[model samples]
Target: MVSKSSPHKSALKEKEGISQPESIGKNSVAQIIQFRKQQPSAQELIDGILKGDKISLSRAITLVESTQPKHLEKANEIIQACLPYSNNSVRIGITGVPGVGKSTFIEAFGRFLTAFGKKVAVLAVDPSSTISHGSILGDKTRMEELVKDENAYIRPSASGETLGGVARKTRETIILCEACGFDTIIIETVGVGQSETAVHSMVDFFLLLKISGAGDELQGIKRGIMEMADAIVINKADGDNIKKARMAKTEFNRALHLFPPKSSGWQPKVTTCSAITHDGIAEIWEMISEYLILTKDNGYFSERRKDQNQHWLLETINEQLKNHFFEHPEIKNLLEENKKAVHDNEISPFAAASILLEKYFR
Candidate 1:
C-alpha cells in the first residue's frame, strides 16, 4: 500500500518529536550511597567540635544516642576527650507544666542570651511515644527563631526509658556543648513533675515557669518543687494578665519563706515576664547574674558541681545495673512467664518477682 520512498521517509517522521530526559547515572547513585555509609573518626569529631562546628557536634551526639556497642565506645572516647574542655558554662534547667509556655519562654530567654553575645545551647528532652518508641517533639520545632539562630544550638532528645524528664546521656551531652564554646546551657524538661528533681541535681540554676493563676493555688504547695526552685518565673504577664501575674508572684514569694535557708545562702526570687511581648526578660537575667555572683563568691558553685559529679557516679551505676538485669536473654524469657503467673494469681506478685530475681542471680 506504500511507495518505496514513502515507506523509508514518511511525512509523520518529518514533524518535531518529543525528547526524553537523560537517565540517572550509575556513578552518581554509587557516590550517594558511599557518602551515607561514611562515618568520621572520633578524633576528627573532637577537632571539629573544638573548632565550633555544629555538624560535627550533631554527628557526635547521634553517636552517643546509638545503641550499638561500637558507637557507644566511640561516644565514650569523644566524651573523655571533651571532658577537659567542659564545665566552663552555666547550666540552667527550665521546667514547667504542659501549656505553661515552656518553649516560648525558653525561646525568649535564649534569644536574650544570644543577643548579648553568649553562645546558648538548649537541650530539650521530648516525651516519648508509647506506640513508636520515638520522640513526640524532635528537633525543637516549636522554637523557630531560636532554632535558626547561629549562636543558639538546640538538641531535642527522647526521654526513652529514662524515668526523669531528661535523657540518660544528657549529662554527657552537656560536656560536648560546653566544649563547643557554649557559655549558657539550657535544659528544657518534658513537663513539670518528678522530672524537676532530676533537672535540679544537674543545674546551677533551676527556674520554674508558671502561668498566672489564683493566689490560693500558688500557696497550696508548701514544699517539694517549690523548695528546689531558685526562681519561680510567672510567664504571660502582658495586658490583662499583668495584675494576676503580680498576685501570683507575691503569693509565690510568701510561700518560698517556709522552706529552710539554702546552703548557698542565696534566697529564692519570684519574677514575672511575658514571653510574647519580651517584657521583663532582662530583669530575669539580672537576677540570675546576681545569683551567680553570690554563689561564686561563697564558693558554693564549685562545691555543688563536685556534689553533682558524685551523684551522677552513683546514678550511672544504678542505671547500668538495671539495664544489665533487664536486658539479659534468660531474664527476658523468665520475666514474661513470671508476669503471666502474677496476673493469674497463681503466685503472689512479690513471690513471682523474687523467683525472677533469684533466676537472674543464678
Candidate 2:
C-alpha cells in the first residue's frame, strides 16, 4: 500500500522506454528491419550450391523443408534449376534394427570412403514425435568420427509423420548433396521396419545391417526387407561375437538364395563387419563397387534410376492430392462433425465420407 503507485508508475515508464525506437542502437534497429525485408534468391542459392558451398546447401535444404507457401514456390524453382546437375552421386540406403550399431558402422564406413579421397554425404532421418512433430532421435551426436571428417557431410532430418521415417524433402536433399560434389549419398532410415520400403524406393543400393544372437538370425526383420537388400552385413563381428556373426552371415546368405533372382541379376551377398575393430569394412565397400560395375555395365543402373524418378512423380502427385483434400478449410471444418456422426451411428462412415467429399469437390 505504501509503494504500489510508485512501482506501478516505474514499470510503465520502463516499458515505454523499452518500446521506443531510440532504445535500440541505430545500426541494430536497421539490421532488424533489413532482416524482415530480405529473402534469398533461387538463382543465388543454385549457384552457391553448385559451387560446393556448404552454407548455401544447408540454406537451400531448409528452404525445401519449409512448408510456408512463399518458401515452397522458391524451393520448387531451386530444385528445377538443380535437377540437371543432380543424380551424379550413387545413392545408397542403409537400415537395421535398433542396437545394430548403425551409427558405429556408418562412422567407420564413412571414414573408410573419405580415406580414399571420396566425398560422402550422410542423410539420417530421425523419427518424429507424433505429438510435437519434432525429431525424437538425435543422429548427429551418435556419429562422432564421421561428424569430424572434413570430406563428409551429415544432415539429420525429422521424419515428421512420413510413413518411411524419411522426411518428405529427403530425395530433394540428395540432389542438392550431389550438386555439391558428393559422389556417394547414404540415406539412413529410422530403423528396420515400415520405413525400409521408403528408403529402398529411393536408393540405388539397399544395405541392411544385422547383429548376431537375435534369436533366429533374421528374427525381427521382415521377409520383404530381406528381398529388398542388395547386401546384408552382420555387425559386431568382434570379440566374443565373431563366431556368432559368421554363422549369422551364412544363414542370411542361404535365406537370400531362397528368393528369386533380383532384377539386376547381381546376387545378394552376406558379410560380417566389426565397427569397433574396423574389420571387413573394406570388403563391404568392394562388394558395393562390384554391384555398381555389374549394374552400370548392363545399363540397369540408369534404368533403375529412371524407374525411381517415375515412381517419385506419381508418389508426389498422390501426396499433393491428399494434402489438398485434408488441408482444405471447408473439409477441415466438416471433418469432426462427420466423424462424430459416424461414431454415434447417426451415419455410416462411408456416407459421412461421401458427404465430406461432395462438399470438398464443390
Candidate 3:
C-alpha cells in the first residue's frame, strides 16, 4: 500500500511542475490580450478608412492578408465592422499583356483620379507559383508615384494557393477599401489568359489593356477574356506604333461586336491609350463612369453586386471545406498513400481517388 504522505508529496510535485508553466502561459496570454486591446481595434481601422487615411488602409489590408490564426480572427472582425460602409465604390479590374504597361497605366490613372479629388485604391494581384505558392509583390515598387500619393493607396498581394491571379484576400481587401471611403478600387492582375476571369468576377468593370503589334490581333487574347472584357484599350498609341494601335483598335472593335452583349446590358467599348504620355487616361475613366451610370440606371449594378455576393459566399464555403478536408490527419495520410499508389500504378488514379474519398466520407 502507498503511504498517504508519499501520494500527497507526489501530487504536490506534479501540481508545482504543471501549475507554474500554466500560470506563466496564462499570464503571457493575458499580457498579449492587453497589448492587443491597447493597439488599434478593427473599428478604429474602419474609422480611419472612412476618413480616407492611407496608413489606415494599408494597416487594414495587411491585417486582412495575414495568414496567422489570430490575424485571421482580427481580419474577420475588421471586415464585419467595415461591411456596412463597403460596396459603395466602383471596383474596376485591369489586365493586359506582360509588357503592356499595366503598372504605368495604373499610376497615371491613379494620379489623374487623385488630381481630380477622388480617392483611389489599387489592389494588385501578383501571380503565385502553383508548385511553391509564393509571389513577388512587384507592383508597389513599379507604381512609385501612386505609392507616394496621399489620396491613393497601393497594395500588392499574392495569389497564394489560389489558381487565379487575383489573391483570395483581394475580395476582402476591396471591401476594406470601400469601407475606407475610397471612391474607386482598381484591381490589377497578371495578364495570364484565364486568370483574368478571377478579376472579372469581382469587379464592376473589367478593362483589358493591350499593346499594339504583339501578335495577330485576332489571337492577341484568349477567347474567354475577350468575351469578358468591358473595354479593350490599345496602348502604345502615342509612339511610332500609333498607326498600328489604331488598326488594332479597329480589329478589336470588330471582334467585340461578335460576342454576346454583357449581362449588365452595357455594350463593351474599345479605345486607345498611351500610358507613357498619360494620354487618354481621363477618357478611360470617363468611359468607366459612363458604363457605371448606364448599368446603375438600368438596375444592373445592384443585380450584379448581389450575384457577386452570392458567388463569394459559395466560394468562401468551398474554400473552408477544402481546408478542413485537407487538414484532417486521416485524410492527409490517405491522400499521401493514394498519391503514391497513383504514382506506382497499383490502382488507377481515378479509382485511387474514389477509394480515398470513400474513406474520407466514412
Candidate 4:
C-alpha cells in the first residue's frame, strides 16, 4: 500500500539518501520555542484553576513550592488571586506509623467521598533521603483506585528541608487545591515525632490511623498526639484480625476518655475499620460530618481557623528569619570558620554562636 513517494516510505529508505522534509524538524523547534515563550501569567493560571483545570492547579502548586527567587513574585500573585476562591474545603490530616495502611485507608476514604459527588485532593508527604535529599514519591502508585478516579487529585510532595514527612509549602498547596474546587483536602504526614503537631496546626480534623497488635499499644505515638487527635481509626479490622482490632478500639476509647476535655467540647472517637474490605468507612465519615456540624454550630470552627492563621503568621516569620540568616553570604562564611574553631576546641560552641549572631545582626 506504499505510494511511490510516500513520506513513510521515504523515512524507511532514509539511509538511501532520500531527503525527508526538513519542515518537520523546523516545526518541532518552533513549537519548543513557542512553549518556552508562553508561560502562563498569574491571571491565566488563576482562570484555569477556577475552571477546574488540574494541570493548572499542579503548576500553581509547583510555583508555590519553587525555591528559585525568580518565581517568587509570580507565585505570590497567583496565591493572592486564588485566595478569594479558597478556604471552602474540609482539610483532614492523616497520619500513622509505617505499615499501618495509611495509603490503603486514604484510597478507600477518598473514593468514598468522591462517590458522593465530592472532589477530593490528597496531599501526601513522602520522606526524602537524608543523605541524597531524594524521595520515593510513589504515593500515587500505592493508591491505585483513587489515582485512576477522575474526581480525585493526588499530589505527592517531597518532604525536603522539612521534618515529619511534610513539605514546607504544604499549607500553600492546600489553598491552591481549595481554589480549584476540591471540596476535600487530605494531608498525609510522616508518622514521626513532631510531625503530628505540624499537621494538627493546619487541618480542620486530625485522624490517626492505627493497627492492632503492633507491639506496644501506643506504638511510639506521643501522648501529645493522642490529645490532639479528633479521631483514632483502627485499620485492618478484617479476617482473623477482627477481635484484636476491636480490643484495640476499646482500649483506645477508654484511654481517650482520660484526656482533658477538648476546647471544641466534642469527644474524640475510636473505631475499627478494614480498608481492604471497605467496612466501617461510612461510619467514620459520619463521625466526621457530625463533628463538623457540632463545631460549626458552636462557632469553634471559625475560631480554630483564625487561630491557625495567626499561628502560621508567626511560624512564617520564624522560618523566614532562619532562612535569611543561613542564606546570607557573610553569615555562611562566619559559620564555616567558627564551626571549625569549635570542632578543634579553639572556641566554645556558645562563643561561636554568639559571634555568628552578632555578625548576622550587624
The lDDT per prediction is 0.88, 0.87, 0.84, 0.89
Per-prediction RMSD in angstroms? 7.7, 4.6, 10.9, 6.6
Tell me how far the alpha carbon of residue 145 in candidate 2 is from the true structure, in angstroms, after superposition. 2.3
Per-residue lDDT for 53-107 in model 3, tens only?
Answer: 7777788788877767678788898888888988888999999878889999999
In model 3, where do residues sit more than 4 Å from their true spots?
1-44, 130-132
The residue ranges of model 1 lying beyond 4 angstroms of the native Cα positions read 1-30, 214-222
Clashing residue pairs, candidate 4?
A: none
Evaluated with lDDT, which candidate comes out highest?
A: 4
- Total backbone collisions for each predicted model: 0, 0, 1, 0
* Candidate 2 lDDT over residue span 113-218, tens digit each: 9999999999998888778787645667898878888899898888876787764599889988998889999998888468888888899999999988887565
Off by over 4 Å in 2: 1-38, 218-221
Q: Choose 1 or 3, whichever is better by TM-score.
A: 1
| Winning candidate number (TM-score) | 4
Q: Candidate 4 lDDT, tens digit per residue, 1-362?
A: 87878765343444666665776677888998998788788888999999999989988888888877667678888888988899999999999888999999999999999998999999998888889999899999999889999999999988887867553488888888999999999999887667888999999999999999976464434688889999999999999999999988878887887789999989999999999999999999999999999999999999999999898888878877887899899999889999999999999999999999998888
Order of candidate numbers by lDDT, starting with the best: 4, 1, 2, 3
Report the error of model 1 at residue 143, Å.
1.1
Off by over 4 Å in 4: 1-38, 218-221
